[model samples]
Target: MRIIDAHHHFWKYTAEEFGWIDDSMSAIRRDFLPADLKSAMDAAGVDGVISVEARSILGETGFLLEHARQNPWVYGVVGKAPLSQGKSAVEEYLAKTLPGADKLVGVRDVLQGSPIEVFSDATFNDGLSALAPHNLVFDLCIYHNQMQATIELVDRHPEQRFVLDHIGKPNIKDNVLEPWATQFRSLAERDNVFCKLSGMVTEADPTNWTAEQLQPYFDTALDAFGPKRLMFGSDWPVCLVGVEYPDWLSTVKTLADGLSESEQADFYGNTVLKAYRIDAD
Candidate 1:
C-alpha cells in the first residue's frame, strides 16, 4: 500500500507550541521532526506525507515550506495564511507562489475558539475568494461547536475543496455523539467536503479508547463520504498522547480493513491527493 499520511505536525520544542501535552502525556514532550517521522512512516509503509500546520509565531507557513523544501518524502504542506486578511493578501500569496510552490497544497486557520464568525464576514469570504486563483485546498480545523458556521462557509464556497480536520474534534472522550454525528453526516453530504480520520484517539478517553469506541463515527463518515472522500491522517505527535505513529496507523488499518484494496487506497492516499491535487506517482 502506498500510503500518504495526510495530517501531521512539526515543532522545535515541547515547551514551545505543545504545552497541551505536558505532565499527562510526557512520552513525546520533545520536538519531532521529519527525521523522527521517517522511521514511523517507513514502518507503516507511508511513502509520503503532507505536513500540516503547527500553531506558531503566526504566518509561519514559510517555516513549513522551508522544511518541505528540504524533504523529498514530504509530498506537500497544508500550511497557514490568515484568510481573514482580505483578498489583497491572498492575491499576494497567489502571485508570489501559486503553482508548484514548495508543494504548498492549502491554507488553514485553527478556528476552535476564535471569536470571529468568519463564515459570515465579508473579509473572510474575500479571503476564501482570494484562494480561487491559487487552486489550493482549505483545511478546516474546528470544534463541534463551530460546525454550523463551518458548514455555512462551505456552502458559501461550493467550488473550494476542504478537509475537516480531526473529524471536527468530536467529544469522543465523553462518549457523546448526537449532534456531532448528525452534523458530520450533513457536512459529509456536501460535494466539496472531506473528512480526516485523524485525532479521534486523543478525542476519546485518552488512556482507554477501543477501536469499537471510535468505529461508529468512522463508519458514519465512510458511509457519508464513501471511501473516496475520506483521507487517512495520523495527527502524529499529538497522537502520541494516546497512541504512537505506528499504533495510530494500525487503528486506521482496523477501521479500513473491511474495504477491498482499492477502497483502502482511496482512504489512505488517493482521496487526499485528489482533494489537494497532488500527484500519487
Candidate 2:
C-alpha cells in the first residue's frame, strides 16, 4: 500500500517514568525505541511513520527529535513543547531546533483531560501561535467530550492545520455515539482540520470487536474529512493496550478494502505525504 503511518509514539523509561503506565496496562511497561517500531511497521507494510510525544514532559520532545535524526524511516515527529510556554521561549527553541526541520513536523497537548477550556489557557495560545511562521502542524489528542473545544481552537487559529487524533476519541466502549457524533460532525466542517483512522481497536470492546463494530466511526470520519485530509496512524505503543501493530493494520485494511484504489491511496499514503510535508529521497 506504500503507507505512511503518521502517528505512532516512543518512550524511554527506566522505572520512575513509566510508573504512569499502571500495571493495569501491562504491554507498554518498558522502553520502546525507534528500532522496535521500525521492525513492527515494516512487518505491517507501513513504509514510514512520525514518532509522537509520550508523557515524558517537554524535554522528551527534544530527545525524540534527536532520535528521529538517526532513524530516517521515522520520517518526522509531532513532539510536544506545550504552546502555553509563551512565544519567546518557543521562538528560541525553534531557533535552536534548526536542523530539526526535517523531523519536527507538529505539536500536541494532553487535551483528553480539561476538554473545553484547555486551549483557552493564554499560555497555550501563545504556544500555538509560535508555530505560525514555522509552518508546523498541530495534532490535537482530545477526549470525545472535549471535541468542541478543539473546534473552537481551530476557529480562533484558522492558519493552523489541526489533525484530530483518533476521530476525536469517540467512546466505542460505552456504545455512546450520538452527541459525540453530532459534535464531531460539526468540527469536521472546519476545513483546516483533519482526522486519523487509528485507535479504534483500543476504543472498541477490546475483547470483541468485528469489522462491523468499527464501520460507522470510520465511515463518519471519512465522510467528514473526505479522502484528501484523513490520514492513517498506528498510535503504536498506546495501541498495544488492546491490539498489536499487525492486528490493527489488518483491521484498517479490512475497513479500507471496500474503497477504490484512489481512496485507498488517500487514506493510506497520500494524505500523510501532504499533511506531514514528508520529503523522502
Candidate 3:
C-alpha cells in the first residue's frame, strides 16, 4: 500500500508569526522546513505527505507551494487564505495563487479559537461556495465545541469536500468523551466530510499519555467514519510535543491492526488521495 501521511506541516518558525508555539513547545521553536520533515518521513517509511498550513497568511501558501515544487515527496498542500473575508476575497486569492500551484489541494483557517458564530457567517459560507468549482477540499481544524457549528456549515455545502483535522481535537487529557463523541458521529453522517487520525497524542496528557488512553478515541473515529473515510496524518512538528514521528506512526499501525488489508490501505493512504483529489500517479 502507498503510505501517504494525510497531514503534516513545514514552517520557517518565528515567535511572532507562530505565537502558538509557546514555551511548552520549545522543542519546535526554531524551524521545520522540508529537509527536517524529509528526515522524519524517511525514518518512518512514509511515501509522501500533504503539507498543511501553519500560519494563516497568503505567503504561507506560497511557501508550501515552493516546497512542494522542489520536493517530489510532498504530494499536496492544504494552504490558508482569507476565506472569512467573503466570496470575493476567496475568489481573488484563488485567482492569484491557484495558477501554478499544482500541489495545492485544499485550504484551512484555524477555526478552533474563533467564535462559533463564524461557522454560520453568511459571507464565510459564501467563501466556501467558491471552492467547489475549483475542487478544493477545506480542511476543518476546530475544537470539539465547534462540531455542531461545523455540522451546520457542512450541511450548507454538500457539494464541497471537507477533511476534519485532528479528529475534532477531543479532550483526551481528561478522558472526557460525550458531546465530542456524540457530535463527532453526528458530523460523520455527511459523506462529504472525512476525518484525520492525527494530533490526538498532543491533545492527551503529554507527559503521561498511553496508547490505551488514545485507543478509545481511535475507536470512536473508526466507528464513526469507518476506515474508508478516515486517514492517517502525523501532524509532524506539532506532534513532536506529544510523541515522536515513528512512535505515533507505530501506535496508529497497532490501533489499525484489526482492519483487513484493504481497509488498512484506505485508512493509511487512499482516503487522503480521494479526499484531497491528489493524483497518485
The per-residue C-alpha lDDT of model 2 at residue 116 equals 60
Model 3, 133-164: lDDT tens digits are 98899999999989999999999999999999
Tens-digit lDDT string for candidate 1 (1-281): 67888899887774757666668778777878878898888887788888888773445677778788899888888877657788888787667665557599888877787664666899878888777567778888988878888888899898888889988988888888878888888898898888888989878977999998888878877887898989999998888888878878888788777899899878888988898888758
Give a tens-digit lDDT track for model 2, residues 1-281.
Answer: 57888888888766676665777577788788888998898788888887888773778788888888788787888877646678888888777774535688888776777746567777778778888678788888888878777777889888888888888888888777888888998998888788898888778876677778888888888888887888888889888887889888888888777778998888888888787677764
In angstroms, the error of model 3 at 86 is: 1.1
The order of the candidates by TM-score, greatest first, is 3, 2, 1
Point out the worst 10-residue segment of candidate 2 by lDDT.
93-102
* Candidate 1 C-alpha error for residue 21, in Å: 4.1
What root-mean-square deviation over C-alphas does model 1 reach? 1.8
What is the clash tally of candidate 3? 0
Q: Could you tell me every candidate's TM-score relative to the true structure?
A: 0.93, 0.94, 0.98
Measured by C-alpha RMSD in angstroms, how accurate is candidate 2? 1.7
Better of 1 and 3 by TM-score: 3
Score residue 280 of candidate 1 by CA lDDT: 52
